[model samples]
Target chain A: MEVNDELVDKIAALAKLEFKGEEKEAIKGDMQRILNFIDKLGEVDTEGVEPLVYMTDETLKLRADEVDQEISQDEALRNAPDKDSDYFKVPKVLKK
Target chain B: MYTSFEQVKREIENGKTVEDITRNYLETIKEKESLNAFLEVFDQDAIEQAKKVDEKLKNNTAGKLAGMVIGLKDNICYKGHAVSASSKILENFESLYSATVVERLLEEDAVIIGRLNCDEFAMGSSNEHSAYGAVKNPHDQNRVPGGSSGGSAAAVAAGLCLATLGSDTGGSIRQPASFCGVVGLKPTYGRVSRWGLIAYGSSLDQIGPLTNTVEDSALILEVIAGSDQKDSTASTKKTDAYSTASKFEGKVKIAVIKETFETDGLDPEIKKNLEERIESLKEQGHTVDYVSLDILDKLVPTYYVLSNAEASSNLSRYDGMRYGYRSERAEDLESTYVKSRTEGFGTEVKRRIMLGTFVLSAGYYDAYYSKAQKVRRIIREKTDEMLRDYDFILSPTTPKTAFEFGANDNDPVSMYLEDIFTVHSNLAGTPAISIPAGFHSNGMPYGLQIMAGSFEEKKLLGFARTLTE
Candidate 1:
């Protein structure tokens, strides 16, 4: 598939990233080249084959619904770039 | 230049205090500062930990890894210590809890010397993508040490630390080990816990060891591998006594993958070394034959598709709200995310995240992501079938030895292709290792890769020890 500038913009938006003017052009070329390379996967006949999501045959192990360990609220919010006393502080989601 | 864990352990037993050993490594780390291997050296904490180990040794109650100085790749979390994954997005981020592997190492009295540098979020083939800057090859300062665990490999190669913990997704650990002329092992996918490791590709990533010798690699694996309640994907299989790997004696059937040697861009010197190694294995009574892996051409593409798809989803949490780098220019939530991510991630990371977004985006998911998954299963089944007949698969760890800086800086495809031989084991979910085979004419070291079926790390490591010996 041809990865054009419009598609690049869409992907960048979905990825929550914005490229500068020249970066967008370079990213477009890179995306196109990489996509073309990965396009060869379509040639392999995967008829009746299941998609392998997990490498191991073992299913995800279940644990009893109990808190084995707990961290204080201060510890939980320690790495937040901007955090109030009990919660993370983000920029306004709703504009006036 | 100490190569074995036993040598260090013997010194400790012979009255060389753990504090002295730790101080020696700290001195080497300072002296070799130009290698740019470590992001942070835990000098004070390491010395204190060594004192405790020395106390234990005095009481004759030392642990398996007592007094061993080790380094952790920046991605592995050490509680209350910085773990950035060598990216600005995680700059100044301190881990709240240690990784299970880190906890295990501490339990065995391993003195963690420091956190080493790596590719940004473990994305690039060369160490150039690190926010801190590139790590130079120890053999020749102008060349790369092969990444994304470049610093971990280079540290062990240069004796900055005896061994280091590095996570492998695709070829992160093994490729760097090959370039740096050290031993690196990527165990079966679920063999090691991924709990406190910063996730890049959830499915493909496994934490392993880079060491100066295969026995040291085996010892580290034995300590770190097991089921973890915190990591559901960690295997529930019983952990083997990997330290006893030398006891196993058998003539194994080994297949040299024909397509790997025939691939374009493979250095002729590496090919010759692999050929000679095969002859030597045959002379030692092991059956060595050439096998054609038709799916070899598709491995790089399949690996990129799946790994990037997972990376996009995994990295979505790095938005400016909770943790990591935040942009001051943002006035709103959406702008915060976009601006923070744009300014925080490096070019290679952005390229991958964009590629991942494109593959997983609407109207193209089936064409790229789903098809790649199906092809992954095909590759896995083919490898499994081959392993059913052969005991192990052998190939060159990388296409070439360490290359000069800016060699493939402009060409991402060439860098991605460098992982072609190593990614297969990750996709197949099998255990594989890279051992220094010989030096190139340029004097840089190359490695021979050995892979075995899933959960066969003991056999693989045992045979690797034989080859290295």
Candidate 2:
């Protein structure tokens, strides 16, 4: 339950959250509380029961693999927070 | 003058304009803005739909809920309307198609007046985690309307809408209904179609109605419940007329799960009210038996593990590339997927996703996910076994009425405890209805839950109506 910096960073990585200094500590406390609740699961005896994966007695049916009308590239990109004419823009990755 | 559903229907039928009814309700919603019950009121669309219904009424073709203004929880889809889930990620996205429930209701000439607010992705217990804002208890503005179906419950409580459709994953529908003093039903898993409902813990999610009376809930459930080719998971059985309860005859025996009542977390007032309701049932000549589901204690943790695991997988479909709210920066596909999900989902959602990913990860799947699934089966088997002798199961819908907003913010486990009374029905895949039994000392309503076997929604609603009466 003693949440320090390293464990916080690891959880954040797993969750894909981008956090700076103070926020990390806050999330760590938040995570600790959640973990505490999860720990309660250990108390139950689940030996013979089958875990329910989905609620339905039915299975999902697959639709025919047909092409639907395609939205124009510009239309799709219209709501993007950052985009170039041809592709979505992002921070440079491979090289400087 | 029109406090009941029958009154509304009768008055509206007698040459009243749908616009007038919707306008009157919108004014009420506006006046009660402090409750934060709605994300957006679609006044123009509602009036327009109502006018159409009025025309139908004039032509002697009025449907079941003609001109009845309904509130849709933000997560349920409505064509050409923003389906935000009260989250920033889907903030600007207008739904491309209506959910099956919405489509069915529209066909019945029910007017959708507004999109009710909810916890983001229907994730939280208190409705506090909504990106838009927390919905306050309609009965007491300072307290939360229990969530993530909080807004829908509050809307019905405040008379802002005739009835609302809310998705129950674990206890979302019934918990809030308990808090707000309305009837909320969580149908057997496949009773209502989920197509176009934004996925939230897919396996546990179901769409059901929240209304002032159990009969109205049944009427709405009949219109919206049934098999739909659009959602394969919808039951293949013909839609049984749920409102047949109006003519239902006979006294039913109900089992009150003793272990659930004895649990440490139940509030004294709630416990007291539950006992009184049981006594009332007995007084009505219905046999009341004390049933014990020795495994009742496992409901919450089992629910969280199974729901979160499925949620982690179902929600993986949302990435920057395919859906709303993509991040501006991304290194590659992996990073884009990670970053968008990380940033898009709220803290509680992230925690569940993380727990799910961890449990289903390489070494731990057997230890966590597999184990949880087994426990789930046991819960269902035990519940099904218990149902054979008892006509229904009864319990408190929530441990207490609405708590102050942020009351459990520092302690998520405390918040999760609120679902204690209602989680078992979801785990067992049974139909359950929560009806207001009485008020707490604080003057807010407390609800009693009645659960029945799969496809026994009408029976459950009938019993609930009898109890509430």
**Best of the candidates, TM-score:** 1
What class would a CAPRI assessor give candidate 1's docking?
A: high
Query: What is the Cα-based TM-score of model 2?
Result: 0.93
Residue B341 displacement (Å), model 1: 0.6
Q: What does chain B score (TM) in every candidate?
A: 0.99, 0.97
Which CAPRI level is candidate 2?
acceptable
Over the stretch B368-414, how does candidate 2's per-residue lDDT look in tens digits?
67877888888888888889888998888888778997789777778
The candidates score, on chain A by TM-score, as follows: 0.88, 0.78
* RMSD of candidates 1 onward, in order: 1.0, 2.6
The fnat of each candidate, in order, is 0.89, 0.52
Model 2 chain B lowest lDDT segment of ten: B321-330
